[model samples]
Target: MKRNNWLSLLEGKYRVEIISLCVIIVIWGLLADFVVKELYKLPGPISVFYAFYKVREVIPLDIAVSLLHFSMGLAAGAVVGITIGGLMGWFRVIDRAIDPLIEIVRAIPPIAWIPFAIMWLKLTHYSAGFIVFLGAVFPILVNTYAGFRGVDKVYIDAAKVLGCDKGKDLIKYVAIPHSIPYTAAGTRIAIGIGWMCVVAAEMLGASNAGLGYRLWSRFYLLHMMDRLVAYMIIIGLIALIMDRIFRYFVEGKILKWKKGTVAV
Candidate 1:
C-alpha cells in the first residue's frame, strides 16, 4: 500500500516538475561542459552546488539586507500608492489634475532613478529602497486607481440606499472591498519588480551589502561563474517563496470569498 501510494504521488504534476527539472539540469550540465568549456564562464549544476557551500556563511546576511531593502520600499510604495491612487480614483478632479504628471513620471524607468537616488539618499540602504520604490509604486498606484474606478454604479447606489451616503462610508463599505483584488494583483507584480530592483539597486553600489552586491562585485566581476549562478538561483528561489507567501495570505485567506468566482 505504501509503495502504491508513493507511485500515485509520483504520477501527479509534482512528478512532472521533478522530471523536467532533472532534464533541465542535465542539459545545463552538458552545455556547460561541452559548449562553455570554462568554469569561470559557465559552471555546471554540480559546480554551483559546491559554490553554495562557499557562500553559506554570507548568504543569510545577504538575504536579510536584501529583504530589509525590499520591505522598506514595498511598505512605502503600498502606502503612498494606495493612498494617492484611492484619492485620485474617488475624485475625478484629482485624477485629471494628477494623472498626467503620474503618466509622465511613470514613463521613466526605475534604473534611471538610480542616479538621483544615489545623489539624494547617498548610497545607503535607503537609496536601494528608493530604487525599489520606484519600481513598485507605479504598478500599485495604477492598479489601485483602476480598481476604484471600476467600482460598479449599482454597488454605489445600493450602498447609498442602505444609508451609507457619505463618501467615506461608501468608500469604506463598497469601494475598498471591490478594489482589494486589483490592489492584490498590483502588489504581486510590484513584489516581482521590486525584487528585481533590489538587485539593480545594490549592483549599482546603492549599498555595500546584499545579494545583489555579492552577485555583482564578489562573483560576476570576479568571474566566479559558479558563485554567480548560485546567487541567481537563490534570487529566483527567494522570489518564488515570497510570491507563494503572498498568495497564501492574500488569496488563500483574505480573498477566500473569491474562490467561488475564480477557477480555484
Candidate 2:
C-alpha cells in the first residue's frame, strides 16, 4: 500500500516527458535539419550524435574538465557556506553586522564577476570554480543561516531544563538537529546555482573542455542545434542527479522526526 501511494504521488504522466522530447526532436528535424540546412547548411541531431560517438573514440576530455571545476567550486562553497551561515545564524551580533556585506555582493550576477575572476585567478579552473562558488555560496549561506536562526525557542527552553544549558551543548544537542531541514533546503538550492555557474565560467576563457566550452565552440562552428540540445540535456541531467542525491540522503534521514512539521 505504501509503495503504491509513493508511485501514485510521482506518476503524473511523467513518461510524457519522453513524448515531449520526441515532439521537439521532430520539430527541430523539419525546421533546422531539413529547411535550415538547405539554406545556411548544418548537420542535425543525428549527425551531432555521430560526431559525439566518434569523439568518444579518442577521449572524453570535456566531461572531466567540467566535473573537476564543478567539484572544486561546489566543495569550497559547501564547506565555507555552511560554516559561516551557521555561525551567523547562531550569533545575533555577527548576523546584523555582516549581513549587509553579503547582501551587496549577492545582488550581483555571478557572471558579472568574471572579469575580476580572470584578473585574480587568471584563465583557469580556479577562475571557473570561483564563478561557480559565487553562484552557489549565497543560497547555501542564506538557507543555513535561516535554518540556524529558525530553531524553535521551545526546543531550546526544553533543552535548558534538561541540563543542556551550556552554550556549546545547547548548540550541539538542540540547535543542530532543529536546523537540519533548513540546511538541506539550502544545500539543494546551492547545487542548482553551482551547475548554472559552471557553464558561464567555462565559457569565460576558463576552460578548453566542458559542456559550456563545447556549447560556445560548437555554435561558432555553425553547430547551433547540437550546442542547444547538448546543454539542455546536460543541465537537466545534472539537476536530476543533484536532487536525487539530496532527496536520498537529506530527506530520508536528516529530519525524520520532523518530517511533516515541528509541533508546538
Candidate 3:
C-alpha cells in the first residue's frame, strides 16, 4: 500500500516536470555533442558541467554579491514605492501633483540609467543597487496605486461607521488588507525586473565581482564558452529559485485565504 501511494504521488505531482526536464536535457546534449560542433557558440552539457565544477570556488562569492545588490535595491524600492503609491492613491491632490513626474520618469528604461548610475555612484555595489531600484520601483508603485484605488468605498464607509473615522485608521484596517493581493502581484513583477537589472548593472561594470561580471570575463577575457554557458544557466536557476520562494511566501503563506477563491 505504501509503495502504491508513493507511485501515485510521484505520478500525480512530479512525473511530468521531471520527464520534460530530462527530455530537454537529452535533446540539448545531443544537439551540442553531434549536430552543433561549433564549440564557440554552444558547448555540450558535459563541458558546461565540467566548467561549473572548475569554477565552483568563485561561484559562491559571485552569487552572494549579486544577491546583496538585488536585496538592497528590492527593499528600498518596495518601501518607497508602497508609501508614495499609497499616499497618491489616498489623496487626489497628491496624485495629481506627482502623476506627471512619475510618468515621465517611468518612461525611461532602467538600462538607460546605467551610465548615470555609474557616474553618480562611481562603479560600486550601490550603483548596481540603484539600477535594480529603477527597474523594480515603477511596477511596485503602479500596482500599489491601483491596489489602493481599488479598495471598496463600502469598506471605508463601514470602517468610518465603526468609529474608524481617521484616514489613517481606515487605511490601516481596510485598504491594506484588500490590497494585499495586488501588492503581491506587483512585488512578483518587480522581482523579475530587478533580477534582470542586477545582471545588466553588473555587466556594465557597476560591480567588481558578480555572476554577470564572471559571465563577461569568461566570454571576452578568457574566451571560455563552456564557463559562459555555465554562468548563464546559474543566472536562470537563481531567478527561478527566487520566483518560487517569493510565491511560496506571499501566495502560499501570507495569502492563504486566496486559495479558496481560485480553482487550479
Best by TM-score: 1
User: Residue by residue across 1-29, what tens digits does model 3's lDDT show?
Assistant: 45786467557767888778778988999
Local distance difference test, each candidate: 0.91, 0.76, 0.87
Go through the candidates in order and give the C-alpha RMSD of each one to the true structure.
2.3, 5.9, 3.0
Candidate numbers, best lDDT first, in rank order: 1, 3, 2
The sequence of per-residue lDDT tens digits that candidate 2 reaches over residues 1-264 is 457854564556675676678788788668766678742354566765655555553235666777788888888988888888989999999899889999999999998998898899987789899988888888888988988898888998999999997989988997777777777777777787888888877776666668778767665456565544545566578778877876777756766766643211
Lowest summed lDDT over 10 consecutive residues: which window, candidate 2? 51-60
Of 1 and 3, which scores higher on TM-score? 1
Error of 1 at 136 (Å): 0.7
Report how far off residue 52 is in candidate 3 (Å).
0.8
TM-score of each: 0.94, 0.82, 0.92
Q: For model 1, how many clashes?
A: 0
